[model samples]
Target: MKYEGKIVLVTGARRGVGRLLAEHFLNQGAQVIGFSRHEDDEAQLPGYTPLAVDVGDPESVARGFEQVRKQFGRVDIVINNAAVLTSQYAMIMPAGAAKGMLDANILGTFLVSREAAKLMRKSKWGRIINIGSMAASLEPMGDSIYAATKAAIATLANVMAKEFAALNITCNTLGITAIETDMLGQLPKDKIDAVIAGLPLPRYATAEDIFNVVDFFASERSGYVTAQTVFLGGVN
Candidate 1:
């Protein structure tokens, strides 16, 4: 288990990508702390402690990190997997929706990453994997605001990688197309069909697909792979 004894923090762990990520890390023997606004007691995952925190608020994010540090000596890895998606056409989207997207997707990621880096700096080695999306590059319909937030995540990874290189902290973005998650279950069939049709592989991503990438990022070989945006899309 590469992550044996390592303390890994994963945000948005109640469901979807985040939950899968936390499970994978724990399976690798990592002591994982999951932060989600909702409480998911039914999961009963081994070696995982769930912390309730609203990442969209800086205060909540900070407090969550404090709790993590208090419980686990140090945080070795952080997966910024928590995000909110607003799929609305640019012309019809209201200002309020745009603001909410910015608060949760962009600002929340910043706050969590910043706090996690502070803890990692003391540990001398760390891995920060940001969960991004193909929407940032593909610019899909009705995804303008969501795409903008993920693009900011890419930028955050670039700067954090350069700034923390000396401290042995690697920051990278894992950009992927749609995955089969409860979140995507909300979408209508036509929309999902259109996305799958455009995919070169003719299928959507799975939680396992995203987990493989995260595992790679947390490996020792990834030390030299900082600042890179790795696309999980099968096309290229």
Candidate 2:
């Protein structure tokens, strides 16, 4: 229970990788607050508090953190896992689709990280883990906008690492590729197969794979490891 007594906030906790991460933290004895646009009543997990908020909206993010402060006294860790991906070639990608990607994948990560840092500074120690994508470096087809957003997240995390260093807050990005989740289910079969074949591991990543890296970042032992993007799935 490395995170025992810590207060953790995870965005997009309703399902997929976010949900798995939240559960992992709770299992480690951390008080986990899940932020998503809607509540996951089906989860019904003990020790997990679900908060409804659109991370893309500044007002919504502010209110959500206010509630966290009021209820938890402080936030010790923040996992910016909320993001959206739409597969479309840049030439014909809809404007609204692009905007949605920007709003959730870009704006949402920024807003949540900004607010979480405020609460974390109170204790002079915290962990900020931003979920990133290999698409940023790989530049895979049908992922231009999504990759751009992930690139922004890595940049933001790097700056936050430097800015928050004095406060003992470490910021890092975990760029994952070909994760087996509902999000991946949206891609065409051929595309998914091709990605898997190219990966050195030659297999899709599981939620457990992501949890391993996140667990490291959330540990007190990882204080010196910041401003780095740790890519997974043997992509590089």
Top candidate (lDDT): 2
The predictions' CA RMSDs to the true structure, in order, are 1.4, 1.0
Clashing pairs in 2: none
lDDT of 1: 0.86
Model 1 Cα lDDT, one tens digit per residue, 1-236: 88897999898998988888888888889988999988778667788899989999988888888888788868889999898877888999999989888988888888888888888899789999999988888787898999899999989889989999999999999998878787677668788788668776777788788888888888888888899888766533
User: Best candidate, TM-score-wise?
Assistant: 2
Candidate lDDT (C-alpha), each? 0.86, 0.90
Model 1 vs truth, CA RMSD? 1.4
- Minimum summed lDDT over a 10-residue window in model 1 is located at 227-236
Residue 160, candidate 1: Cα error in Å is 0.9
Cα error of candidate 2 at position 175, Å: 0.8
The local lDDT score (0 to 100) that residue 192 gets in candidate 1 is 71
Model 2 TM-score (2 dp): 0.97
